[model samples]
Target: MKKKFILLSGLATSLLLSGCWDINEAQRMYYVDGLGIDYKDGQYEIYLQLINFTNVAKSEYPNPQTVPAEVGQAKGKTLEEALFKLFRSIDQKVFWGHMTFIIFSEEALKDKNALSIIDTVLRYRETRYQIWTYCTQDSIKDILLLTPILNKSLISSKLSTPLDTDDQETFVEPVNFRNLVIGLNEPNHEIGIPYVTINKNWETAEQQGQDTTFIGVGVLSKSGFKGLIKNDAARGMQWMHNRTHRGEITFKLDGDETDFLTVTLEKIKVDIEPLVKNNQVTFEVVVKLNATLNGLKTNVSEDEIRKKIIKEVKKEIRTTYKEALAKDIDIYRLSEHLYRKNVKVWKRLEKDGKIPLTPSSISKLEIDVNQVNSGRKTFTGTFND
Candidate 1:
């Protein structure tokens, strides 16, 4: 009787343990790794990036083979309708649990459509909040079709993992779905998202290769896509953000003939102070950077070097601020600073955003750069003869 009761208990436990009875087979599931969305003619265009798992996971296979990624497209009046249209064409069960990144074209991100897409994605039970977010002005089809060089999987490419390159030298910090959602809710603010382009600066053994690169930042508000901040203005905008990371800088000394210094920035911080008086607001910008001297074309003291860095950094900040104001973009987030520090003043000044920010709005711009000790180390030793 005891043995029979024990056997019965074991059977009950086994029945409870059948948790995966409803699990779908991997072979029957189509894993979506990347998503690209574009808008045209009052319709939503959806593009899906699906890579062969065999090529994506090399170590698991004894002799891994390269497989070109497959991209599919569908259009509809609504995002769901378009998605379902694409679903009707595919034979396998599509899965969103493995989505790595999402790309929004400049057109699709307009008029708060980016927020709409995020809302839809979040509603799906299998969707991820950590998926990297980006916007591009390039061709989505061309980008999805370009495979990684040397048989490498898209898993390792900048398209899927951008911070891999940003860590080396950050231009614009990468944004994720969760980050975008939170940023969109900020009052009177637009977020800086990485702006990408297709670059053909690489070559393979047989032919030139193409890859995706973020040249500047794409600013998006609840109002939707503002515009692209390209070139130095984009880079300088980063230097003013709290997310500023390590990067290289080259600046020439003022009033000098080709006397320049190159340094790699380390721990960087940006601070903004809003001074309001008589219902008038002005922002004071201060930037601090710990940097390592990389190259020097002229001889200068450490103090002079620090001063030169400060001058260059301040100039860059002012330049970016000027450009941002022209486009009605608050790259420095000065509006938020005022809203938090002096709400009443912000209200008065915010009445007419037509000219909320002007060149004179920045009463002060300062920079503090500290140098890290580097170069060949000298060791003293004693030798006996």
Candidate 2:
């Protein structure tokens, strides 16, 4: 009976000690939603965007106004040091498990130690591999300070959510931490990250709003910060890289500046073939597109419009390829493709150290456009009529 009494007493004590021992109250923790990294003057600057649950959870009706998140900054010689310095100013333990996105300043990427910063982030236990990554030429602090205009969620949501969520599709593909790491580890060490900028417009004296806009893509080579590809060039890279989904294209009809045609992309398929002969390499790119007419101001049939689109897509692809080659930016990832398909040739080239291949090495490029649906038209007028 004494042994039984002792066992019961010990069980009670253990239960009391184990219950919620490490549990922190919700009010005592800061949930970081976004992280921004910048480098200047041999120092690393860290920016943390913390979501305010209290403000986000408000139940008020009729235009409730409350800031959803707040930003904090700190600087040090290393990433860890910067983060620790940031923690010094906050009373609550910063939780990073909920982080949705990360932004790196262009200046940070220009630094030779940019990859080291990424390695540091991967080492953290709380950091996630799937977090979206972006690069911006603007101030990292300003990017983090952007507040959501029409949405109630945090401003960082714009960068975190998939680009296809909106009605209009994005040109550049989204890159995550895992993809960035993989690219950096590739033989060529080339990668492209989506670029973001602020769109500031003053509407009225009482109301001035600023929103975040994805401008284009920033390319990174082994040397770092190659350049930026925007608009048509970015779209062209997406096609060659087979990263395009659904996006709208606007072009002039019959080379007339006033007559415009806008088409919505339905599907795209790209085939890249790498051929090796006598220690020389050449690539052939074939692009197939399925699209529909969204709007037309030209007096041409659907067949004619299809031909125009095919030509335009081919032009875009060639222009982008040439530009990348001139700048020594391998956005098409031709070397990676060769390594995957023709291993022996790629290894031989790598052993030789610095393969002498140019953009002109792409000998052939063909584009085939198919109009799946022309849509119903209220007015039927043809140039032949």
Candidate 3:
């Protein structure tokens, strides 16, 4: 009887020990890494950047060989139709959950087309809100096909992780999809997303390569896509943007011809006050930043460096406003500033469709540079000399 009970228990354990019979191999699935959307002539085009799961994970592959990403394109009368048409051509099971980036073409922003595309993306159950969004005037296929340098995983590209680059370079701030939606919803507010382009400056012994970089930002208004502002003109954006972490500036002080100073700045602080007087509204902005001398070509005091940096900062902010004013763009969202601080004035000007700020609208500007330090090494001259 004891032997019979032992046999029955062994048989029951075998039933519960069955291995995973329903799991599918990752090698059999096509994982989309990035998406591209474009619209022109009343038609929609979709591009997909597909990655091999083996390349993305270390243990997934036995040999560990890597290949460049694959880009596929399809077109239809609508965004969904284009996506489905692309699906029809794919051979394996498609996975969308790992997608990290989406790019839109300039033509796609016309006639409220951006709205429908954004809505469709959010409606997809597998997609996430953290996806980075960008606009490109370059070829969608080219941007999607650009691979990581040194043959690294495709996930290493700035398209998938922008803040990685910003931590060191800190140009136009990279923003994700959720922040984008909030910018559009807020009344009279303008938001910016990175403008991606293919840079061909890198090459290896056997082959040349392309890298995606931001030359500026694509500004968006509530109505639709506003326009793009170049980086040099938007220099002040690094500070007024409220998201700047660290950046560098190089300049020559007054009365110093042969000497120039390169400073690395961090800990940016900005304050904007909406000043209302006699039914007219203007904004006063004050900015504070800490500096470290990276390169020095001539002798100068810490006090002089601080004052020169302040002057440069003030000039950059005014120049940004001046340039955007030429394009009829309130790049700094001064309209929204007024709306939040002085709603009565904003409503009055908005009712007349006159809230688009002027150059004089930035009534006062102040910049304070502080906490100077000698960087890794000094160049050409000594700070004491």
Q: Name the top lDDT candidate.
A: 3
Pairs with steric clashes in candidate 2: none
Off by over 4 Å in 3: 1-25, 59-65, 254-258, 351-354, 376-385
lDDT of 3 by residue, 193-233 (tens): 78888999999998887788888887776677777777688
lDDT, candidate 2, 11-49, per-residue tens: 999888867778888788898888999888899888998
Report the Cα lDDT for candidate 2: 0.76
> What are the runs in model 2 whose C-alpha is more than 4 Å off?
1-17, 55-63, 164-167, 201-206, 351-355, 378-385
What TM-score, computed on C-alpha atoms, does each candidate reach?
Answer: 0.87, 0.89, 0.87
- For model 3 the TM-score comes to 0.87
RMSD of 1: 4.8
Best by TM-score: 2
Rank list by lDDT: 3, 1, 2
Residue 236 Cα positional deviation in candidate 1, in Å, after optimal superposition = 1.3
True lDDT of residue 267, candidate 1: 77
